[model samples]
Structures are given as C-alpha cells and as structure tokens.
Target: MTTLRRPEIGSTPEPLDLSFPAMPDRLGEVRRQLREWLSRCGIGADRAYDVVLAVSEACSNSVEHGYRHGGGLVRLSGVVTATQLLIKVTDHGEWKSRDEPSDPRRGRGLQLMAALVSDAVVTSDADGTEVEFRIPLDPRLSS
Candidate 1:
C-alpha cells in the first residue's frame, strides 16, 4: 500500500516496508535498516535513535504478546515526511497477556513511545495489535 504523507522536499522518500517473522532476533536487523534509511533521509542522529528505540519496543511487544497459537508476521511500514516520521508495527496475532511484567518495566514502552512522538496509538482486537507512532521531525531538529 502507498504511504499517506508526502515529503516536503523532492518527491518523497520511499517508504520502508518490511514483513518479518514474529521472532525476537529479527529486531536488531529491523532497527539497523531503519537507522540507515532515516540517516539517509536527513534525519538527525537524536531523532533517529528515538525512532529506532520506539519502533523496536513496538516490534518486541508484537513478538512477545501479540502472537500466541503459532508463529506470525510482524509488519513494519512507514515513511519520514518533512513534518513527521510515521511508522506502524502490526502483528497478525491477537494480544494475550502472559504474566505481569516487572514493576519498573511495566508500561515503559508505551510511555516512552508517547514521550518521543506527537502521538502513539496501540490498538488490539481479535485480529491483532497495531502500534503506530507519529513523531514530529522539525521540532526535534531545532531542539
């Protein structure tokens, strides 16, 4: 599917579309790919790091909580526009809580995502969970 946002300069940077197995080991590779692309797109180092971290956390949640019956697909898709960096991490399995996480770590992923971005939304239903983050780019660039 085509990405919604248009980059301010030039035509637009091609969206990064990835579908990988719902496994933990793949996350590092995903972050690496995103970091390279973001840097190439003129994203500053600090913002790139925050985006990578938030995306990694979302992907980790998909593999750890979203899949249950068997292995599934985790889809990462989005593009960085002039105004914002928008990414979505979606899993094909419904979220099922396994056990309470440690006190210090609980809810930190979601919190960090929201703190880093203008908006962070996590939606879970029968199909699966989708964690979407929209981070304003220019503001971070100036800060």
Candidate 2:
C-alpha cells in the first residue's frame, strides 16, 4: 500500500495579489484583507498577528507620508515559499530617504515591524517606497 500526501483542507493557500487606491480611510480594510489572506497561507496564529500589525504600520506610513498628492495607490502582494512567507507593500507616492528617521514616536512603526518580522526592508526610488517583510515560523512558534 502507498501512503498518499495531499494538501490538507485550508492548508495550501494561494498567494495574495491585490491592490487598493491610496486613501487614509481604507487602511483598516487593507489590513483586514491581508490578515485573512495570511491566515489562509498556513501561517501560525502569532505570525499572522504580526503580519497584520506590520502590514498595517507600513500602509499607514505610505498613506501619511509617501503620497504627497493623495491620489496614488498601494500595491500589496504575498508569496509563500516552503520555508517563509514574503509580503511586499509598494506605494507610488514619493521617494523618502532610506536613512532618515522621521520620529521615534510617530515613525517608530517601521522599527517595531523590523523587530517583529524575520526580515524587514525599505526601498525608496523616484517612483515611491517599497517595504518588504518576511515572517518565519520557527520550531518555537509552529507548535
């Protein structure tokens, strides 16, 4: 007899491919959709919570600082590999210097996100800002 392996129900989830118009009021909805998507990707409860928090922080910053014209858009994507979950949030507002710290209290979102996720990166260009974070479920949390 051969033992078969199949994707468990709700275990193998698809990547998230979605975009939203950049509006300060839509931030909460953006985070909600992201949270559900991450949950479906088999991410642990704790990791999913972190993803929600980090993504929300990044998006809020984009809305507040990234877009000066207030009519841009925020692009969000999630790609799950065997070992890690990758989330990319991109905005087409303006290029911010990657080295400067806006403020500890108001700008500390990125700092907290960096500490929560396995990896956090912020890239800025003439087009806009792109923030990426990877959440890894290690043996300690995957149980």
Q: Pick the candidate with the highest TM-score.
A: 1
Tens digit of lDDT per residue, candidate 2, span 1-143? 11112223446678887788788899888888887887666565565676788788888878777885667888889876655677899988884565876665566777777767748899888878899976654433342
The TM-score of candidate 2 is: 0.80
| Per-residue C-alpha lDDT of model 1 across residues 1-143, encoded as one tens digit per residue | 11122234674568989999998889899999988877666666776777788789889888877775679999999877677777899987977553645566475777777766647899887778999887665533332
lDDT, each prediction? 0.76, 0.72
The superposed Cα distance between candidate 2 and the true structure at residue 41, in angstroms, equals 1.1
TM-score of each: 0.80, 0.80
